[model samples]
Target: MTTLHTPRLTLRPITPDDLPRVLTYRNDPEVARYQAWALPATLDSVAGLVSDQPLGAPGWVQRAVTLRDGTVLGDVALNTQGPQAEVGVTLARSAQGHGYAHEALHALITHAFTDLGLHRVHASIDPRNTPVAVLLTRLGFRHEGTSLQSYRHRSEWTDDALYAVLAAEWTA
Candidate 1:
């Protein structure tokens, strides 16, 4: 299992014990607003999602983002495909505006490029999520493009923005 540490946070593989906390934040309307997860996430469903995939397996892996004192803030998710990967992060409502997401994502991206030797990492986010767009920009990801009304989300056609960073472009 990969465990990464930032100055104030730790990114570790998600475990069974984190299901409830993950469920709680995942079900939060605000937190789920731009996320792709089904609504009303249950503990059993969360467990099934987190436990089915082993950490070093060939698909998605989730990491728990916690404070140094062991408080669960949220999670960072990476879906790897050969030398490239897609990434996402979620923070509890109370954890927003605290820079924890930035810190956690930095650690994850650095690990992806430096330790995992990924060629590229990217994210596709709802265009409406300005905060995430800014966060990605701050992390040195370039805005590749936006797909207009490419998919139906929450009963409406929504635009998706793609942002990416290459291993050679990553600074840390």
Candidate 2:
């Protein structure tokens, strides 16, 4: 039961009701362009995709990104069990360019570095996602490396850019 509040958004666990909201953007080709998952995410499959969170567990937890009034804006995921937690974010088209994603992710990453005592926090994003790459750079995450043809999306091989921030370097 983790709920993090930023100035304009709240990050909490996913519920069945959130599937439709998530599916809307998740199914959008423009939004899912550089993401790994396939398009047209079905309700049944998405409903069961909700994570119970279960912190300290060995996998990822998808959290709902919402407004104070509970309007779903997008979602974020954190792979909580590793030495360096990995994070990913998806925001509705309407919510983009508003800093909501940065706000939500900053809170979660702050927790990962401080409360969770993780040594580092990282993300592997498609190189084509320039916006996210810029966002990560602006957040002080170092561009660690790039792996070519490391990820398969649809039927094509894509390059991945690895960005990370060390706990010792996390000023926030």
Candidate 3:
């Protein structure tokens, strides 16, 4: 398991104990608005979801983002493919706008490129998510393009915005 640290947060492997916090946010309508998980995430389901992914493997791994004092603020998901990774982040409602997401993601991206030897790190976000778009742009990810009505989300057609940062282009 890889543990990443930022000045204000730590990104560590998600554990069974963190499932309650994970369930809370996963069920929050606002938090799930842009996410694809089924609503009302149960404890058993959350555990199953976490247990299903293999950490440090060629697949999705979830990391719990915490404050230095160990307060759970959110989680980051990384789906590793041979020389690339797709990343996603979710924060507790109270944690939004505090820049913790940026700090945690920066650490994850840094590790992905520098330690994991990935050639590219990218994120696919809903087109309606302007905040995340801004966040990715601020972190040096280029707006490659948007897939029109790429998938049906919550009974509506949703566009996906693709943002990417190349290893050579990354600062850390």
Q: Which has the higher TM-score value, candidate number 2 or candidate number 3? A: 3
125-169 per-residue lDDT for model 1 (tens digits): 998899999999999999999999999889999999999999999
Candidate 1 segments exceeding 4 Å error = 49-56
Residue 104 alpha-carbon offset, candidate 2, angstroms: 0.7
**Best lDDT goes to which candidate?**
1
Ranking by lDDT: 1, 3, 2
- After superposition, candidate 2 runs with Cα above 4 Å error: 54-56
The TM-score obtained by model 3 is: 0.94
RMSD of each: 1.6, 1.4, 1.7
lDDT comparing candidate 3 with the true structure = 0.87
User: Quick one: RMSD of model 1?
Assistant: 1.6
Show pairs that collide, candidate 1: none
Clashes of each: 0, 0, 0
Q: Which ten residues in a row have the lowest lDDT in candidate 2?
A: 48-57
* Predictions in order: lDDT: 0.88, 0.84, 0.87
Residue 88 C-alpha lDDT in model 3: 93
User: lDDT of candidate 2?
Assistant: 0.84
lDDT tens digits, residue span 107-159, model 2? 88887877778888899999789999999998889999999998678888889
